[model samples]
Target: MKRDQARRAYWSQNLRYLAGLLLVWFAVSFGAGILLVEELDQLRVFGFKLGFWFAQQGAIYAFVVLILVYVVLMNRLDRRYSRDEEDPA
Candidate 1:
């Protein structure tokens, strides 16, 4: 019963993390790129328009970063759960 509770809590945390990362991706890809492109185009990033950059490159970069972050988080979560199992109170 305790083990099941721990597993459920871990999964809940994982879902929250996934949701936040996905929200970021959606905001960058759709919101910045399409919804606010004209306004964002007034800004520049390394010689490229901010909106155009987000549509073309920024979102992809963010997605890759999110993937790495997820992997790292999951690894830490796994290690923590394993450690808990090894040293129970």
Candidate 2:
């Protein structure tokens, strides 16, 4: 029962992280790139229109960052669960 509970907790945390990251990705890629492109195009970033940059490059950068975030978060989860296995309550 304890093992099952722990497993569920881990997966729940994992899913939560995934959902949050995906939400950010969607906001960046879909929202910024398409939905708000015209408004954002008024702004400039590094001499490039903000909307164009987001549509072409910003979303990709965000995805890479998200991948890094996922790796770090999952590593922390792994370490925490491994420790839990090593020392029981």
Candidate 3:
């Protein structure tokens, strides 16, 4: 493929990965933390209310995990598309 096309494809895939991951993070932080807090409150995680835990600690943990996941995904993507860097744009 041409350099321009490869560059576009690489960027497109990177954005797709980002969008999907962000959606998951939003669902966990916002959806579980606020929207579903009432329902989740009835449950418990190590004595703390599930919803409260999610609102406070869960979101932080999820964000960290998401960062790691993004790093791995980007590494794979970069390895696959790094050749684009060699081609003059």
Candidate 3 lDDT over residue span 56-81, tens digit each: 89989999999999999999999878
- The runs of at least 3 residues in candidate 2 whose Cα sits more than 4 Å from the true structure, single-residue gaps closed, are none
Q: Residues 1-89, candidate 2, lDDT per residue (tens digit)? A: 66777788889999999999999999999999999999999999899999999999999999999999999999999998777666667
**Regions of candidate 3 where Cα sits further than 4 Å from its true position:** 84-89
Q: How many residue-pair clashes does candidate 1 contain?
A: 0
**Cα lDDT of model 1 by residue, 1-89, tens digit:** 66877788788988998899889988988998899999999999899999999989988888899899989999999898777666656
The list of candidate 1 runs beyond 4 A from truth reads none
| Candidate 3 residue 38 C-alpha distance from true site, Å | 0.9
TM-score to true structure, per model: 0.90, 0.92, 0.87
- With a 3 Å backbone cut-off (N, CA, C), the pairs that clash in candidate 2 are none
Q: Listing every candidate in turn, what is its Cα RMSD in Å to the true structure after a full C-alpha superposition?
A: 1.3, 1.1, 2.7
Q: What C-alpha lDDT values do all the predictions have?
A: 0.87, 0.92, 0.91
Ranking of all predicted structures according to lDDT, beginning with the best and ending with the worst: 2, 3, 1
